[model samples]
Target: MKYQFFWITVLLIFSLSACKSIQEKANDQFLSGQYQYAINSYSQILENEPDNLEANQAVAESYRLSNRVEQAGPYYEKLVEEEPTFENVYRLGLSLKAQQKPAEAKAAFEKAKGYTQNETYLAETQRQIEAINLSEGIEDYFPNYELVNYTELNTAGADYAPVISENFMYFTSGRRASGIYPADGSPYTKLFRTRAEGLRVDVGNIQTLPEFQNEEGLNQAAIAISPDGNTIIYARGNSTSPKDLPETALFASYFRGAGFTQPIWLPVNEDETWWNSTPAFSPDGEELYFASNRPGGFGGIDLYKATKLANGDFGNAVNLGPNVNTPGNELFPRMTADGKFFFSSDGHPGYGKLDLFVAEKGADGNQVIKNLGENFNSPSDDFGIFFSNYPKEGFISSNREGGAGDDDIYFFEDKTPKPKIVNVLLNVFTKQRVAGEPDAVLEQARVVLYDSSNDQEGGDFSNSNGRVRFTLEPNADFTIIASKGGYFSKSIPYTTRGKTPNPEDLIQEVTNITLDTTIVLDQLILDKSIVLENIYYDLDKADIRPDAAVELDKLVQILKDNPSIKIELSSHTDDRSSDEYNQDLSQRRAQSAVDYIVSQGISADRLVAKGYGESQLIIENATTEEEHQTNRRTEFKVIEIQE
Candidate 1:
């Protein structure tokens, strides 16, 4: 009998120890923000002791934090059903409201009224019911999005960045269509064109750009077309060179009025190093904008711009500055015919991952960017958005739930009211060196402008001049190109001032651009290279000031005319700071120029950005501010031939 009693005692001790261990774990998890785990533990205890009010209540609280209000509703209802107390009834009603069952929720609130007669909870519940009723009457401003894959087109590896133009849709995918390099030896992302047709559902018939294929790995995305559908600009990375990842740049090809022209790399100054991406053209095709991670931006990636000049050259680039850029990555910008800018971002607070945002030119011409709201966004990643100016239909790429693949393209329609017209100016120019003059004469060249930024054809060049001028609707960005034999072909950097057109300014003002003559081997051999003496920056700040904009803009024009040119962005800093910091600072400064060019619609791939920091100081042991400024300078170098 004593032995039996000893065994019973031992069993009792063990059971108590297990219970303590479970409770301790539950408490620890609860305090550590592991509410789901805590709820599971508490549930185990409640299963053994159904009437354990504390364990039951803990489960309810956990459910609330986890956004599982429907699960919490039953537990609270049971507590009220058994006790019929004012507190229990009120809690039950609250849970029902949270679950969004307004009619049933109201019934629970009415029951609570019988117990408490509290006017505040009664009024709040009544208000909630009314709000729900109101919300039901209004259509969800944001449409539900789902990604559908064209399995007939996509292969085993990757697919993304879809763009629609006229009857055809173009996208960058990793399919092994003819001319595509294999995944193992030569990895590349190529531009695939497809004809998409349908109303409620559309099917895309895919075809690869055979003529533009390169042996290098291609990371292509963010495509744009000219208004006449004769030119195309797309982003590309070095896929053929595996060691060269994240070195993606932008490239352009003419549609030949029949098929695509041979693809060519845009040029940059020799000193800078950075990757460019996401080319968007204004309606007139005079300006281009793209994103880059080069230095001098407010943060990671910033937008920049370049212009087409009279000499059939692209002028220098300008940074878009803080108004349109932030510390986080700003990418995939699309312009509407009305001059509104659309892009995806994670820096701004919204529903989740990367939310779609619209920025319009404010009355003062500054960009005012705003979130589209919760109905259009979720906790998952949303990106690569495009919109049509006509039917107003749009598509976005996302990895959210209900996608056909890893990243599916979602089609959506905008129900929001059409934006009002704001008149803006579109300009194009070219440069030609006068026979006897040292300066190049900026004159009208044959300019073709397209509104690929907003996925709409705005206007075409029926006129000849280095300059093509037109009234741009507000909320639009455009791409402008100029071509003449013997003179290099040039493209305008993408730009959007986002301003309401002042008729007064439009009446007399003209957006002027000057392209320069192509530097033949003879002329280039004479000078070889030119040093940019004025690419300056302030103390400790990488922000590109207006003065720097003037010079960089000039360099961009030079590249535009000579499509075969490739350049590098380089930075040098004084020896005052730590080498690492100086290197970083110099890199930032160099990137600032690259950012400016990209915002102008120069592709990131054309430019390579590097920072020598104090290592390449021009003025060693300089003590003066001017000397330090000399040391802390930025420069560019030509890298490759685009021809």
Candidate 2:
């Protein structure tokens, strides 16, 4: 028995040693930028100990560093709830943004601002929060661009940078030989061509380019053909070591009579690479545009212009100036035949690290940069746009979730969204219902408006004319409450679903129509019996009817809205039964109503049930059946007003 126990201890020690060794390996991989391998190792640990904070965080960071933010969201969500450090919270916000959850992402970023004292981090967090806000309502300005995709072309690898020319599509894909790049775990990219018709590509014929263009052990991609299709350019490079920066540069090949020439680096890069890439040619082929991270630039990667010489070489490069550059990256500069300039930027106010933007001439003739908005951009890397057909059809690339790969090519078309020119406005009036006179405008009455979700949208006090106007969204339901001192609060519903004017019927750019509603509040007089409408009871029983319960619900809302006021709910009966029997029935009916209200989350102390019996009647001697039926009614009177 002693020998067996000693063997068990020895086995336990070996198991623990193996576990520790694996954990150390995962940590090493994470530190060395082998995020994919780290992710797999940490995931194995998490399978046994799901709540391990270190393992969860390692997995989350692995996915994030690998540029798969959508995959990191669940882990970060759990980690934020478990251990909300600044990094976890900030990364969680990024994950939320990648999932297109702007509101929640903004909230997380706002919260993260409080956990850090570093000014740069705080500034970035605030900027992202403002970007989320700025992104709202921008889509309304541009025509909706619809993206279409085919299933057969997209693979588990990154496929992007599509350019169409002469009935063929040239793009880039990282699906080569299952070789992995530790930084992102994607294979080396290669340029590929396929038969195409406008926006559609024939995936079955897709094949890699000749060996000269697709050199082994290196990443080469993009064949951004010029407007004339005679010149083709692409980005080529990859890091040889993990500790070194990637050696990306722009390489071009000219289309001679029958075939292409050997590719070489553009002279503008000086043949010494420092992140120069994503080359584009102007419509007239006079100016070549490219993004570079060379020294003496406005930002990390600025768009630069170089004039094409007569000898077919690009001359000295000039930065596109601050108007088109920032402290962050600006890449994938694409120009349309009509002189419209479009690109992707991480420096602008956008939903994420990179967003598609267009530079348009303003009314003052100055350049105006505008984000393409949510319809054309996601909270992911969206770039490499090509105008296969300008303003009508084009192509873009994105790493957004739901794509078939890390990055996928998409076809976009100008759908020309319908003009939303109908303006919906509401003019609400608060009035006092006089006993014997017309409704009198109740000035200074407080009016609060709530949406269908019961969330308060806006509030105002009635003006001198007892009118309050609210801007309502199209096709929405709202509840308005009007209340004043010495008056009972009233609630009214207004819907603009079918009542709104047809947008097409409007002649001007925007047509404004005002909807009118009134909330008639009754005077809150003591001992005044305010009859509840349609309060019915079972024959000879005190049981509340379904219809009666419906009416009672309105009273419940009033009680909740005016918490300081208490009321006495009383029931009346006609002089058909004896006084004792009538009193019993009336008391039971009144008590049933009070019980019903209490069941609906109302305080019991606010309600008092009273049996009026046949003592109080609207008609002292009812000779007609209609008058007798009126005598048997339920009413509530204001008994007490508490502070």
Candidate 3:
């Protein structure tokens, strides 16, 4: 009787194991975001039962959810062709659209639209068709920019999430020689530091941070440094599962005398139920922002900020609300010094995958979201934007094509941005000074504005009345030069510096300003020296002043425009000082001006520096203060014009 019972128990155990269905196993993996595993399970079921509708549908969905929508297309096409159900047809069209086959996707959507009885779904299908048609010819949204891939900091594996502190940049990378993690079968990510000098990053000093490593397994990669550079916060996982969907929490470390202390998990983490990562500190260093899948959030992962207490512990975390968080993930939350918040989301209408976005208050005190556009975002993942005190230039992490690794860091500069404006006009004109008549218009002269910082030049010839109207960017500086044949070039220093509205207003409101100005050029006469205006120095010093830089820039442009022209930069001083001292001071001032021009990329061999002290005063026997001021000036004489 005992032997029979033991055999019966063994048979019952085997039966129970075989009774577990493939659909149940696939469902478990699908819910856990292990789509690859789910795909394998469903594909196994379809191999034995090819026409199993449930298995085929699950297999297609697994491919779509895993960002392998191209692999789902064949399955969806076959299912729709055989079943022709409204749901199947609609899904087939979506799969085609994800592969960028808009025409075919539209045909599938139209076919599905005819079969759907639900009015809401039919309307949604029609909207998708219109959107696809519009996107077929969509223009790039952001201004032209230069993106520099930091190849020096990238490796054959993944590298991303960059944060700058002082002269060093801290980021995450899977470049270690240690073998791939058992989970995910990819190189484990660790914290790395290297020197970042503007856009020229160096990899020679790339070092894996020891204090932030996970000895037992792979640690989290996303990290944030404090404003004072003394503390760091990062994410860490508790499990070493192959799915890599371990329970994660945030941890903090302090920079002690020579190295960082052991990391300590923060108190804000839930009791092993939530997954947390991507920690960022506010510019003020008072709030810590991170992404969490905690309950009570708006569905998917939501961004939360916790206030720092006086005792160094975090307070209760607060949700960022719906303006920024969405039904999809709101990850990599970063704040610029100006209080503009940026994050990444897939729930928003984007070019598939994740896209970067900025959230701010509009003029009406409501939230406004702005997409960074294709220049900074791609169909692949783009997130983790970090600004260096200012927002004009910064670094971003992307998994776009042609990268050195899975996710590489890129630097961008908006040097000559066409800022959003409202009704600002630039009136270009030429002045013809006459003793008795109003300054007559000198038409047909060329008016050019050059931003030397960016090497961007734009201009137009004067109209019939010598007036060419246009607009310009605010809070920028430019050199406006007016020139014509037989005319000595005239340079006007222009600045669009004005008090900008609040951040919210700047995002939505436009300022109106009408600038009415005149540019004058004199007829060139041989051997005549023209005094460069606003060229001044300190009372007894020879250093070039800020005012002098503006004037010297114009001389640099002149040498560039007339490439073959040679000139002499001369400086003069008043007779108040001793003759010897005056001569020495003026010589230093002339050389300083010449050096400034040379720094602007002009050839040193094409110019000469001369000091004609009080000996060659403009106002001889000067007695009045105004006369002495006139003698203290700088001028450039055209020595030779090869043309």
Best by lDDT: 2
- For model 2, how does the per-residue alpha-carbon lDDT over 548-605 read when each residue is reduced to its tens digit? 9999999998887788898999999999989999999999999999999999999999
lDDT (10s digit) by residue, model 3, range 364-473: 98878777777887767789888754666778898788998578988888756455565557787886654467777888898887774844467888988998776776
Quote model 2's TM-score: 0.56
lDDT of candidate 2 vs native?
A: 0.84
lDDT of each: 0.63, 0.84, 0.78
Candidate 3, 144: how far from true, in Å? 2.9
lDDT of each residue in 491-522, candidate 1, tens digit only: 65454544455444544444332222222111
TM for every model, in the order presented, reads: 0.39, 0.56, 0.55
Segments of candidate 3 deviating more than 4 angstroms: 1-71, 76-98, 101-142, 177-185, 241-246, 256-258, 415-643
Please say which candidate is ahead in lDDT: 2 or 3.
2
Comparing 1 and 3 by TM-score, which wins? 3
